[model samples]
Target: MNLTTKILLPLIWLLCAIPAGLVQAQQAGQTKDNPSYAALADLLENEQSREKLINELRTMADETATQAETVAEEASAASSSSRELAQTTRAIAEGIGEQFTALAEVVNGLVDGQVASDEQFSLAGLMEATLNLSLVIVATLLVFMLMRRLIGPLLYARLDNWALHGAGNTPVIRRVICVALAAAVDVVIVGLAYVGGNLVATFLVGESGEQTTQASLFLNAFMVIELLKAGLRMLFSRRYDGLRLLPINASEAAYWNRHMALLIGLLGYGVMVAEPLISIHISAALSQGINTLLMLAAFMYAAIIILKNRRRLAGIIRTKAEQSPMATSKISLHLLARTWHVLALGYFAVVLVLVLLSPANALPFVLFATLKTLGIIVVGLLLSTLLGQTIGRRIQLSPELRRKMPLLEARLNSYVPNALRFLRFLVLAAVILLSFNAWHVLDLATWYASEAGGVLMGRIIAVAIVLAVAAAIWVTCASLIEHKLNPETGTGIPSARTQTLLSLFRSALAVLLVTMTVMIALAELGINIGPLIAGAGVLGLAIGFGAQKLVQDVITGIFIQIENAMNTGDVVTLGGITGTAEKLSIRSVGIRDLNGTYHIIPFSSVDTVSNYMRDFAYHVGEYRVSYRENIDDAIAHLQNAFEELAADEAQKPYVLEALEVAGVVALADSSVNIRVRIKTVPGMQWAVGRAYNRLVKMHFEQAGIEIPYPQSTVHFEGSRQGVAPALKLEQAGERYSG
Candidate 1:
């Protein structure tokens, strides 16, 4: 490769590429006119077109670099020009606006506007507004001071006059005047406060000058007139018993007045009657309803206080009645007082409930109603019981009978009262039901499957479980005749009746517990038990058959326990075995025989158990007597010994009632046996038997009565044949025999 050739090769390639690019540009123009042709051209000439695009991109790069440098210089000059123009425009606009509005461009544009400096006198409006507000405040303070200094004294004088002249022990008219005066005072206070507040707000928002001062004065005068009107209305319309200053009888009137004042005050404050006087504006309907509720509450409160204080106020009535000309003799105050308080409280409570049920206090009212109902029930029950006790005490009866009769009296008292309460509750419940029915909130059909039913059933189940558990306990304890002296010792052991009752009770309780648990579980899963139980019955039958043996075992255990064939300490023998009875139980019987071997027999297999010490036992043994001894003398001596032994302290506990000896039980190979027997305490036979034997032996030994042993005779057998054969043998035999 030569340099000239390389240069010529490059030059040739450039020439070819430039013409090829030109041809491609022309082809692109042709294709642009016919898009279908362009697609075909692209597919066939893609390589050529790409080469052309690469050459064109190199040219574009060179052009873009030069143009970018020119644009950068122009942009810099334009930005500089724009900044200078913006500053000049801002300064000019601000200066012009300031000249027109006569406001300075203080820091952070606080006061920037256009106007002459002479027009800036408006700034003084701030101070003028302030002075006007201060004057209004001073005036309001003077009004307050005047009311407190003058009106308060006047009202106090009125109340004093009313009190001195008011009727004693009665709701007097003078108290009403006092209430009206107090209401007037409240209205004055509120009006003054509202007017002062309005002045402050108006000053804060208003500009100084005649316009502001004129507005302030007009508002002040209007507010003052409104306040005076409100005060006058409150004075004339307010209710109260305290103005009378009566001793005791002005309770109801006093209560009504105070509560009415409170209600009015509450409404005034809530509605903002003065000073920026923003209306609550919830709705006219809502306002009317609330006012109605407030009125009702006022009445309810007054009634409640009256009733609650009835007893305290009763003396007023008595005093007045005594002072009256018509009353010659004293009245029976007891009956009137008794019924009055109860009736008043009851009526007041009912009214209170109604007041609470009003829309404003629905939830609180419902809760209070429930509490009140429960309280009434409880108080009624107590009152009935008290009445019963009073009557019972007054009636002629023996002291013991009277004391025992409390339970009967209580039951009787409880019966009628509880029944009446229950009936009342039922009526209330029916009303509630009707309310729900009217609301259409509950569908009768779906209620069983709904959340409400779930909650209701849950509470019912909880109460039922508690009652069931209580009933089970009662039944269990019913059978247990606790020996009061041995409560601790006997606690571990079941009484006969206890075992019977506990078994039945526990079984029933267990079944109920399981059923309730299952029901609760299913209920949580949203399953209704009414249908579930029906299905379960079918399933239970199948399961029951499959588990018959288990059922039988449990049933057998229950019956054995119920019958109490064996107890913890009882000794019983069973199943062809002979052993000392150790334990009798529901599941099995434990036995330990003479050989000290233990045996356990199931209750089912324990058909015929021999209880060794069922009720009592006998201690029987024999004493040995010598055959050589005189039988009558020995018997008499033994009898004497037996009597003495019975008197013995160590052995006497085992003797039940008597001890006797049955003569000559047997003639043994070594000694004659004299049988003796005695009735002994249960489980005490063995100890008594051993003690008796010792006593008999010692007595016989002392009496010199020997216990005979085995004795035999020996003779020579050769004597019969030896008569002729041997005289010596016969002589020897005779000697031996002798």
Candidate 2:
């Protein structure tokens, strides 16, 4: 219990433990080998030694921490993508090389008479299956051929007659139907072949393990190859002009059809049957190698065909394009001609590479891409043909219809050409997307099933619906306005005011519709349109502030129009200019005066508008006669002139009523002035005024009532102081002596 006792106990335990530890530590070798651990033995022996050991331990910890920091830095750098891309690329290349070498070895072994399959090869079974499939195909062909022999002549004859007669009016629909029917027949023939193959396989080939597989392979190859050839035949029917979908001549069609059919058949049989059989009976390696070799050969053949015919076909296509009636179609044809060879070459290259890259599983990928591409082309052609027929190459509106809707035919003419081009672009985009989908470049189907895709499609549909509704409303309003403006639309001639008001209304409607459509479309597209509207309001406020004159013009113009101050085609005096109101807009009015000078006057500057053509105009003629003439006689002559004016057929319609003679209105120094007032039709006042003036002058002279001329008495002011100054008017060149 004493402190000394505790210390001694601790010392005794330390001594005992040190000896045991020292014995164990001897196996760890000399102190120099592990000084740090050895220091532990001297921990309680010396203070200096303990401090030294502490220093050493601290130094060792520092070194360890530094090494750890270095390692962490290296790891961070490695984690970050700091390495060159070539490294991963090299790794992949090496992997493919190793895999390819291993496959090559397997294939070589098979070639060296070593089969890696569990079952022995059966050449007899293969031959028997092949023979059966051949007989099936032959029987199927014979059946179709006999049927064609019976019906083909009639079909061809009908197609020819239709094409011959249809071209003058329409031929695109006829061509499409003919091609589609022929293609269907070709497909049906292939169907018959497939059925015959199945029957033959059941009854003729007989079933066994390897035999069944072999027979199935042949049947599949026959069906696939025949169907593919059928499509090709539809594209370019041999010696059948009516059935051919392409625009090439019979010889060119026959050549392409034969070559393409052969190539397709070769690839189909090899890939579908031969390779599969080889893989099953011998080894997969051999099958893949054989497939790769066959694909390479086919690629070479296709390359040759494309290269050899490239220029020739391009020239032909160019010629066709040059002769095409539609500019859009011509442009499309030209582009196709320029790029088709490249596309074909690229397609083949891509297929070959894919097949080689994954020989075992590339069959579905390749077949799907090929078939999808063909289908897209066929469908596009059919659609184009249908569209061409529906929205014909040339649209001719009836004279009555054109007259009724004056602008409609022009609008359609302009719209159709651009629509054709736009539709072609849409078709091209669709084709590209479908092709990409088939190749798994982009999985559109997968996207369409996603939430985001659903939202997008819904928004698009909604926007389209909004646009359609807006368009319908606009068309209705426009038609109504047009009917009001057009005299021939069963509505009588519209007044100038009506025309001007309707034009302005149409412009306002367009602006309103566009604004509404855009806002709704944006909302449907998941855009927050509240901010857009706010921004627009702010912008409008800014514009209103900055363009006060414009606003004033518009406001004034509106008020002016509402008040019936002026209308288009009205002869109005505005802002000190007298002219016809030629063009009336919301902001300004265009006026052309009698002097042939055109003026654009903003309504804001118009203090007053004087429309000379309103209701009725006045033709006030003032007649001045010599003082010597009788005022009563002159008045009588004026009455006579009015009578003559009323009798004239050309001036009678304009002069609305009997002329009111304001008798002896003015008595001047040399003559008496009589004012005559008459009412005339609006805008015809000037013509009536001119005719009345002429009649008045003639009547005044005939009645000896002279028109006034200023007369002066020449009594010299200097002669006032003298008696009556004698003044004589003499002719020129007379000399006078004063």
Candidate 3:
């Protein structure tokens, strides 16, 4: 029973297990084949990949954060640098602004007349200054008085005696020393007074007191004026007969003295008192008004003086021009006169502008500029005059120069005054430039610092120096040539071949020098000399190609000249023409024929030349006599006639050798020819031949020698007709008979 039951239950369980297993196996198969199951597995793999991607992203984000922080720190540093640069720029701008503000304040002060308030004025200071100034003045006066009393009379006497007795006999050095001593006496007195006054002032007052400064300036100005006055008096002495330093007429001297005194007084007052007072006490408007009034008064005075002396000035200029031999000097004097008037008007205009339009501070600069310009002009004029006189006197006094180049000396001496005028103009230009610099009209310092200005100025100076050197070389070479080729010495005669050669050499040297100078100047002026030189070479080559005949002519002429083929006055046969050589040039020979026709023969075309009047010449003559006359007798008579000709005083100089008869030279049908030859000096052959002919003729006539004409006897070979035959026969018979 257990086996059956167990088997049945086992069967039931096995059956249930089999059904469940079947269902599970079917589901597994379905699940394995479904698309959704594959999708789920892929989804699981995707989830794992996404987790790894997230971790990588977190690492990248941390690196990005670190980089951002570093960038922000760099940006902050850049901002700090920009702010520092801005601060530096602001500081520089502020500095420039401060400079401009200071300049503006100075201008404002000048315009408002507030400059003097910078310094305080006190009664105690004024009192002390007054007392010190009085003491200085007294001391200066006492010194001046002592000098005048003790030294003046003695110096005056000595000068007077020297002028009366020793001036003419004294050496130039001694005379100059004496004149200098005489002129310096008054200067010494004034100098001593000034020194004493300055010493006293410096001792009494400290160096920086306004009153002391003003007094010292006044005293210095006064001393200068006195010295200038004394110098002017000494230069243009009031006494017409005294030893004067300047060459001026008495009336001119007196006029200059009066004008100079007035000018000096005005200058002293303006410099010492008026300027100080205007600066200290006057308002800008009042100072301008006062300055305008002073300028008007000075202009009026100067204009009146100039107008009054116009005729006198013209006369002086005319006289000076007349004294100079050069026409250029006359022109220069006229130009100077016109320039003087223009300068005066220009000065007046400048003063007017300064007083009316310019600020008060600018007025002082204008005044100072005017004074400096005037001084420069005066110094330039004086130097020009002195240099002109010195050069002229030196030229006149130099015996060697006169002997070497008389004509050149004469010509150069005439140009001395004109040269001086040019020098004065150059100096005036220099002074004007300096004045412009002083007046701040031009920024010369800045301009000079620039490359363009510096290079340009250097080039200009180099060009000037080159020109001057070239001129000096030319002058020296010309002088030497003139001395060597002096026509008066017979060395430079037109007839001399040496002279012609020298002339050509001189011309060629001058052209070479000029060409070299031009090239050098162009190089100095920053020109491309290499290209210029290359161009010149090409041009020269073209010229050489084009002017081959000219070059040939020149070369041939040079050889001819070197060989001494012909001279200017030589009678020569050239280019199939016989004439006297009138002129000789580099490439041609000029000849004037006896018929008054002139011919210039190129050396290249001249194949040959026969100079007739070189050293000696032969005079030959032929005399024809009758066949009956004796040849020996005629030759002897010709010889006698030639001897007589040679014995004559007029023909002796021309005869270098005695006349010789060659006996019978030829035998002719009508006469026998006898040739006579005589040697004579060059250019005298024609005269000697003529004289000989005349003498021979006279001697032949006295000897009864007859000259015969050509005659011929002919015999007919055959008879043409009966009568002609008869006449021919008769003629033949007569010939036979003869």
Q: Top model by lDDT, which number?
A: 2
- Positional deviation of residue 144's Cα in model 1 after best superposition, in angstroms: 18
Clash statistics: count for each candidate? 19, 0, 0
Whose TM-score is greatest here?
2
What TM-score does structure 3 among the candidates reach?
Answer: 0.60
User: What tens-digit string does per-residue lDDT give for candidate 2 at 317-399?
Assistant: 89988976667779888999999999999989877766665665776888878788788877777676666655655667899
Which 10-residue window in model 3 sums to the lowest lDDT?
Answer: 12-21
Q: What is the C-alpha lDDT profile of model 1 across 1-738, one tens digit per residue?
A: 687965644443343334444457566675444343334344336676557656766887788998998899899887988898787667645544543342222221323432222233244554565565555556555666666577655675566556456665223334444556665665767576556556554554355322344334434544544454344333233232244322333444445445545544543333222212111211233333343444456556657666666766576566655653321213433444446666555545554444333434542454345444444443443343343334333234455533434333344443444444444444445444544443344454577679888787677667546655644553334323222112244455445345444445545665776677667756655568887788889888887799765556566767766555554445556788777655543455577877889987665665675655667888777777777778777778767766876898987766776657688888777678877678887767878777767776787789888866677786545656564333343564464322
lDDT of 3: 0.70
Model 1 has an lDDT value of 0.54
TM-score of each: 0.35, 0.77, 0.60
Worst 10 residues of 2 by lDDT: 11-20
Residue 271 of model 1: what lDDT? 29
Better of 1 and 2 by TM-score: 2
Measured with C-alpha atoms, the lDDT of residue 217 in candidate 2 is 78
